[model samples]
Target: MDVTSQLEWHPLLRDPTGRRTVKPRTRGQTMVIDKGLGLHAFEDLLQTSAPYIDLLKIGFGTTPLYPTGLLKRKIELARQHQIAIMPGGTFLEVAVSRHTVPEYFDMIGLLGFTAIEVSDGTIEMERTVRNELIRLSREAGLTVYTEYGKKLWGSTIDAEELVETVLLDVQHGAALVTIEARESGAGVGIFDANGECRDEELLDIVGKLPEPDLLLWEAPQKQQQVHLLKTLGSGVNLGNISPNDIFSLESLRRGLRSDTFGLELSP
Candidate 1:
């Protein structure tokens, strides 16, 4: 039904944050994680919300779990909608740990994925190894997005290390650097055990980033999303969003909800 074209709100009550840039958007980008959605569900998601999603991640080593055909179809569907699709960084980390990087790239290519996530969350990766992986992914014609921070419980971003990592990653041609807040969004990265954002640490990391907009915060919780949107501006890039929350998050970004109503107003 041409969802992107048909979906619209009344003109008078325009988005308070202004018109959202359509697909190929640089900012105000939302990246959603797909743990395991069936074909129908996947299609429905794109039908209803593709325009709001810039990236779709097949979460955490689940790529191989899907039947080869299904995985290929999912990748194809996302690209058809102009969305960059990739397996979660954990899958690539597995490739690194096993020394099967060539196979990894070949498989991703065979599956028709449009992007790759380079992360060191679960394993130790040397800077040289990381840079080469990013470069190789780009050489494979995949958009590279790298992730920072660990996957351990209570992991925190080191301000100095984060600045170094982001700079190095971008220099190697990464599309964006994601801060690793695991799916739980609790006890990891910027969020605490209770899924509450550690404001001081968040501020410290942001202050150190030379290009803050190139960072993608993995804020899976609604409260966390609201806080980041308020603090980072409506145009902030966010990742790890659940499929159900796409519309809800869009509403928040546009200041349509009570939590963010009049947020973009000059008052």
Candidate 2:
């Protein structure tokens, strides 16, 4: 049974924005970062917020740390809820560093992951290698989400470089190019040190992109999420969200929160 079907509120009451897309949504997608929730917590999250979640990333290099049965069960529950589950890009980076790409893919396949994140956040990767990873993941039948920007603090976006990355990544079969904001949402990519959005930089990138929807902005902070939603409209894809903030983020997207109240209703 669909979990959301249990909600009995009228349409307007349930979604004041009236423009929020349902699950299997092309836009307004939410990607949550799972640091290490216990099995019961993970299942509870799916049962409650599955409809709002599009992607579930097992954060960092922790995928191999969970007991085999526990990890497999988490993946199974996410699949049952129609969420795309994958190990974090950093883990793939670890695999690349160790020359274990084949082993990495095999493990994820055996564990039933539905997607992959290709990123060079902490290491240097040649464009050829990056493209090959995307192709390999695609050939293996997993959805690919490529990420741009370094993970270092104070890192910022270079519009020209980002444009090239996005265009080439999509050409190589990546479903979306994520702009790295890390889990802190501060001093990285388009955000300033205080976690505020650098509006001009953001606009420059958005203006240059042929398809802005192909990019997912990682906004883990409430203020950052509101800023992006209000500026880019509610349909902008967001990532790196924390488990605790899932429903709150959804409320903000749908204008149920004060920060974005009557968002779509505004002129």
Candidate 3:
């Protein structure tokens, strides 16, 4: 370690209880959802929370809405900081629905995004289509993460269906399988209307998953994040996080905050 590498001071702070795996991390992944950040805020997010962020998804088909040059620069910036960035799964679904999968890949690859999300939350896709999308994205050298569950806010997890879907998804080459809690994290998937987690559903899935780390829970709210962190422990993979909450979530995960202090983590 080089002491001279130290530079600026923020303030006196509480160090997190346990050491987390640094970049190229396998567990405890955080995926920030970029809705429509301007160039300055995007740069600031990278400068501030790059260490805490593993993946960045430009949420909900907003990738194509960015001016091409700016989008490419954002992708480049995230990659420079060792963060994987990709468009929301729904965006790819739109391409798939429109029979533009090849063109979408060409556009995405040319723009230099490092990953892809394959999901059927909005559009009902056949199993073959889902697998092919996974294969196509991987063949194009993009990391593929598949998502399960409907977008309806009050839809609870169908235990057996969710389990089987995730198992098959991993078999078809999904790097991470996300439970569809939606951008609001309320009234959908594993959460209730007020964004509270369904404990029974959560336990069943986490307790049985072959590799729990491969499942990213979409928790977009503060209270939800705290609840999930306390419940699942430090090694959980969380997604759909608002860009502004990056450091706050990291603090909660590391027990640097009051909410999760003295919590125990799973191996």
Candidate 4:
């Protein structure tokens, strides 16, 4: 199995400008959120774009829906490629709401998710509990990634609040902090009702934030993706990408797409 020798592998278009991230990277990380993928489809995604994808999130509560065998297969495949696969944070929230946080950890650890999202998107979690969950997930041997923002429509970010949360999450052992744009990427946290990026809001946060690479912007729309790529450079970490768009997004990052063609590669 000579990987990177396959005819399908293309040379990166940018010559000296080529600086795509390597595995176990902190920046330029692309996360593909899987929402109930069947075994065959999941296999196809990894076989094709495993090189570009750093994380695979079993979206929302779909974690409980897949058969145990299929779920284990996905985890093993992802790990084989050095990709982290975790159940969505909302499922953890569900467990917390139902007083099943310990049970959630038991199931998640046993089920083979190497990462966990400690988020409070729908429910208002207590700060102490949130920190405890972060610590517990790490204790249970999962890469803890926390998210900030509500899932409600038209919800916008408070720059100061976001900065504080980002600092605390990183300090508490979060690998990264995901900005909540939901799966739709509309009417929430920098996205308008039409799924457009709110430049004013995004710019303000970016300006105030200390370490931009620690933030993974959830830009599910192509237009939004292009805008972020152009504004923040290819090294910006992005999330909530659909399975089919993995190569497309990677193309955009490498300036191989029409939207990014002739755009100067980031140094």
Candidate 5:
């Protein structure tokens, strides 16, 4: 039986966002960034939050820091839960910087990762190189999720450039394009230095995007998630979520939380 089918909530108390598409969803997706967790803790997160997680990112260069067996087991666990797993783009950026892109791809395949995050946050990458990386990831049977924007403090969205990048990325077979807000969700991409949304910039980017669904806003903070959810609607794809915030974010999405309670009364 579907786990949700076992729920017995009264109709009036049901999820305010209505029914979210279950696993294998193409939208309203949540990507969790796992900084570091022991095997037991990882298992607990999966057990409690698997149904709500669409992707698990073993954040940054922590991939090689894990004991090989533990890392592989975590990949396997994510696979079993129908969630995609990938190393953070910073690791790939390092490979790009080190001229070890081939080795990086090989390691990803060997590690049994089902996804790849192609980002240019820290390094400058040509469009041709970006296209090839996306293609290579796709050829390797990995789901390719590319990211837009820079990681520098006070970095902000360039709406026109963003549209161009998103168009080319998805055209080259990238699955989704994440907007870089980093883990802190402050002073980067669409956010201001204080971790607040620069609403004008956000609106500009959204208005200019050819396909808004393809952009996964990296809103790691609770307020950022709420802002994006309210501004972009509940169907927005959000990335860089901390594992502990998955259920809370879902509540906000479903209008089960006070921050989004108005959704409960919407027709």
Candidate 6:
């Protein structure tokens, strides 16, 4: 039952874009948001699409709700597949609000999480606090992925401020900074109220970033995914992907889907 040992059809067809990298990739990373999938469903996801996933986030304040054994097993499974697993940033924000950051980091280490998301989607976080959190996460032996922007409806990106955040975050050892596009993928970050991408705004942000690959755009909807892929090239890092869309998103990245059929991904 070792899926990794099995032959893949990809070799036969040859990805049309010819730029998709294997797992443990530095770019083109796909981060899946697990709202609350049971053990079997989680395992099934890894068995089938582990190759396409780089980060597995146990979505928003739902980690503590799972039975301890189940949560640990899920983390173990993800580690076995070489996927970095972490609790969602919202949960961490709760810890921050309660002034229980020590307890949070302790529990995260005990639970076997390999990563941490430093974000302030719903809370107010100063740059100093954010930098310390990123430093703390690294000190705890965890990979840091920071998120920028608010989760409120209609929140949009400020190109100048975002560039500053990304620069400082990387300087502080963040692996990638994610743009917030809540699970709804509407009226947040680069997307408009209709979940359509505001191309000009998105481009402006990208144009300002010194390292675009250091960002992970949260595009949960298929249309949003297609738009980002087309606009940013197929190698852009993406986050907040739903579990069901793993293979579908991979298809889009490979130019195997109609929307991105002729897209050329960067090598």
Q: Best lDDT goes to which candidate?
A: 2
lDDT of 6 by residue, 73-120 (tens): 999999999999999999999999999999999999999999999999
For candidate 5, report its TM-score: 0.94
lDDT for each of the candidates?
0.91, 0.94, 0.87, 0.88, 0.90, 0.93
Candidate 3 colliding pairs: 153-187
Q: Write the per-residue lDDT of candidate 4 for residues 143-208, one digit (tens) a residue.
A: 988999999998999989999999998998998999999999999998999998888888888888
Note the residue pairs that clash in candidate 5: none
User: Residue-wise lDDT of candidate 2 within 94-175, one digit each (tens)?
Assistant: 9999999999999999999999999999999999999999999998899999999999998888999999999999999999
TM-scores for all candidates? Answer: 0.94, 0.96, 0.93, 0.94, 0.94, 0.95
Q: Write the per-residue lDDT of candidate 1 for residues 1-267, one digit (tens) a residue.
A: 789998787753667767556779888889999999999999999999998999999999999999999889989999999999999999999999998999999999988999999999999999999999998998999999999999999778889999998999999999899999988999998898899999999889888877788999999999998999888888889999999999999998889899988665221
Winner on lDDT (1 vs 6): 6
Name the runs in model 1 displaced over 4 angstroms.
1-8, 12-14, 265-267
Question: What tens digits encode model 3's per-residue C-alpha lDDT throughout 1-267?
Answer: 787678644332444545566789888899999999989999998888899999999998988999999999999999999999999999998998899988999999999999999999889999999989989988999988899988966788877787788888889888899989988888999898888888998989887777777789999998888888777778789999998899888888777788887655652
State the displacement of the C-alpha of residue 71, model 1, in Å, after optimal TM-score superposition: 1.1
Q: Output the worst ten-in-a-row residue range by lDDT, candidate 4.
A: 8-17
User: Considering only N, C-alpha and C atoms within 3 Å, which residue pairs clash in candidate 4?
Assistant: none
The segments of candidate 6 whose C-alpha lies over 4 angstroms from its true place after superposition are 1-12
Can you give the lDDT of residue 10 in candidate 5?
72
Q: What is the lDDT of candidate 5?
A: 0.90
After TM-score superposition, the amount by which residue 199's alpha carbon in candidate 6 deviates from its true location, in angstroms, is 0.8
Worst 10 residues of 1 by lDDT: 258-267
RMSD vs true structure, all candidates: 2.9, 2.7, 2.7, 2.5, 2.7, 2.6
| Selected candidate, larger lDDT, 4 vs 5 | 5
Ranking by lDDT: 2, 6, 1, 5, 4, 3
Q: Record all residue pairs in model 2 with backbone atoms less than 3 Å apart, i.e. clashing.
A: none
